[model samples]
Target chain A: MKYRNPHIPEGINVTKRHPLKELLILLGGALLLIVALSWVFAEFGGGLARLIPFEYEQALVPDALLSSDADSELDVYLTQLSERLQKHMAIPEEIAIKVHFSGDDVFNAFATLGGNVLLYRGLVEQLPHENALSMLLAHEIAHVVHRDPIVGVGRGVGIQIVLSTMLGNPDLNVLGNAGLYTQLYFNRDMERAADAAALGAVHGLYGHVGGAKALFEVIKAERDRMGDGELPAMFSSHPLDQQRLDAIEEMARDNAWAGSGAITPLPAAFADWLKTAALRTESGRNTGNTH
Target chain B: MIELGIFLALLTLGYGFGQYAERRHYRSIIEREKRLNALPAIAARFPPTEPQHHQALVIGSTVISVDYFKRFLAALRNLFGGRVTAYESLLDRARRESSLRMKQQAETLGAEMVFNVKYETASISKGRGNTIGSIEVLAYGTALIRPQAADTDR
Candidate 1:
């Protein structure tokens, strides 16, 4: 039977399609587009990073983290170390390195947009010697030299645009989180490349690879203390600590450089300062608990 | 494997229930719209003629919720950036169903036609975290009630 009204306008059937068929087609198309865009961005994003101007890159750094001339002793020390390391490396003339220290207890360092390298106090305090610290700094510096930060940010923005266009709403937080997670996973190869470059820089400056392996050994000890299970290589952005140590050992053997070198202890003054800082933090936590 | 099985189960359930609900809603809308065709709701600025009796207000409203399948589809669509056809049909049903109900109310009051009909829609919470639970549509208008014998004068 025809479901029509004589008084109503003709040819106005709104719900005409088979719902299942239309939905299946939409799902297939959406999946195809997502995979294709992800592949295209992954393949070409590195080349796009090179196109960004040095001035634009500098603009990306937040002013809050930008250190003025009146930096703290720790900040000054890190800056001097980074500068000394940069002098030995083949970094671009336009890329000026800036190191910032966060007083947080998190034992991690990361390179971000505009050649900014962030080091946590927790990581710095754990270093047994300056060379080990240099190894960590050199790794981050390598990332900045290679413009990895800009490439990461570009991939993130690209994924956000694609997702928002597909979903019909600009729910950036959800897509941004996904983009960051994917970027971290994809950076595994970059991490290895950075480690190699950092090893070279350390070798050039100190004439040995002892400090490179020593840093990973320190990290491995810390991981064991915390009882954090090892993350699978497929999921982790950095190579496993054992793998890194082994790679450094192989590189040292190939060059015939003795892996053992004079290990300079952290300066007494810095050690004293760290102890005082830790005591103050502990007291502050106790006071907070009392309140 | 277990997670994938659960996901497939949810998808199947959403597809089956969502389709059934949509088809049923469309059938109701069509039947009601046909019955109310004589009232002739139009978007014109002015009514065709003045009412013999006093004009009274009439309103109809509905809140429609989407099944889980549509929400999943919408979330996927969000990743790629495109039109959310799932929501398009939802709004269409809400608007049409509300309008038909408004006409039904007008008919009960011996009204000849509805004039200056306006629709308003708002998204309401459906107890789901962050996702839209349901959409409410309100259709309101002035009903032109005519005297018993004056209905034929048109």
Candidate 2:
């Protein structure tokens, strides 16, 4: 009776598939699933959010974030410009556009819920002319009129919720930065539409679309001065500055609107107004009032 | 972005080291299995009574851990519902290693053969939220040793 363990072949229990191949396949599938899910969520959520009454969005606005520099020359000038642009935009009468001048040197301006637009001193201080200033103001108002902020926030929240649920970790913001960057990228289209609408408003107001390019030029110059690490168009909230400049040219030619006209210079007291706003903010911070 | 970087780094390190360690461990396991093959271990309940053999108990146990790479792969697999091949080699190596260790023990006791060989497997969790920290494979059997052979082995 021979009793012995015979040689067993290797690899019967374990597969020999290349780990990297499997990794690639799985990773590709996972990324596709996430991207597809995000797109669907954005579309559905944005559509649903738009259905919410504009009044509801106004009510949802956080009062603390909407504070203006108040009654100063800067505040009055920004509000007047916004109203001027709003007239050209043919915005709804129920919607009121409030422009807030934040004295912080943030080098950015953004429109948010409740028809509230915040312009930072750092960005406005760099504007080369009134036409450019109007362009900036008009672009934000277009967003407000289009109901972008509420819809965008809705899409973002929906994506965040779905991702957290999928990743099995509610605490961890799964794909948080990547998701936010892509969200901004989705806003790129909204920005383009706003840009086009703002151009039309500028042409309507000033009899030409000239110097509307200055807003992007100032932004591009500021971006350059900050130097490098510029986000690609796919990840950014707006098209490339060069692309936008080209888009402006194309729109002007297509509509046969005047491409070249007298460039309107900014108010002579503009710089002083910004400085005064800055001082007001400084004092407010120190006194712990009207922050 | 920083979290993503850290996650990739951990995955790369886990894969590189885990794969190398698994290959080396498999090589050693194969070599040991061949060396211990002379000591037969059987699953049959009864052994032939030949040469008035003596009986003794032999046991071998091995505790093997899953690498981070395999764990991540398994977790991902849970999302999609597929074969968890990442853990296949893990348990395979553990069971084979435990069986070989039992044969080596029986050989030390100068056993002609082992009978009623059995295996036990258990997953040890350290409260790490559904992830198994390690697995233990235990092999035990009765050895039929010749009295003279057992004395000579010592």
Q: lDDT winner among the candidates?
A: 2
lDDT string, candidate 2, A44-77, tens digits: 8889998888888888887786687644677777
lDDT of each: 0.73, 0.83
Residues B16-122 of candidate 2 have per-residue lDDT tens digits of 99999989989999999888887888899878876788899999899998776677777667668878888899889899999888888888787878889999997
Model 2, C-alpha of B139: deviation from truth (Å): 3.4
Q: Measured with DockQ on alpha carbons, how good is candidate 1?
A: 0.12
True contacts kept of 1: 0.09
Q: Candidate 2, which segments miss by more than 4 Å at Cα?
A: A169-182, B45-59, B109-114, B130-133, B142-145, B152-154
Model 2 residue A110 CA deviation in Å: 1.1
TM-score of chain A of 1: 0.74
lDDT of 1 at A160: 57
Highest DockQ: which candidate?
A: 2
Query: A113, model 1: CA deviation in Å?
Result: 3.5
Q: Give the per-residue lDDT digits (tens) of candidate 1, residues A71-120.
A: 36655677788888888789988998888765557788888888888777
DockQ of 2: 0.43
Q: State in Å the error of residue B47, model 2.
A: 5.1
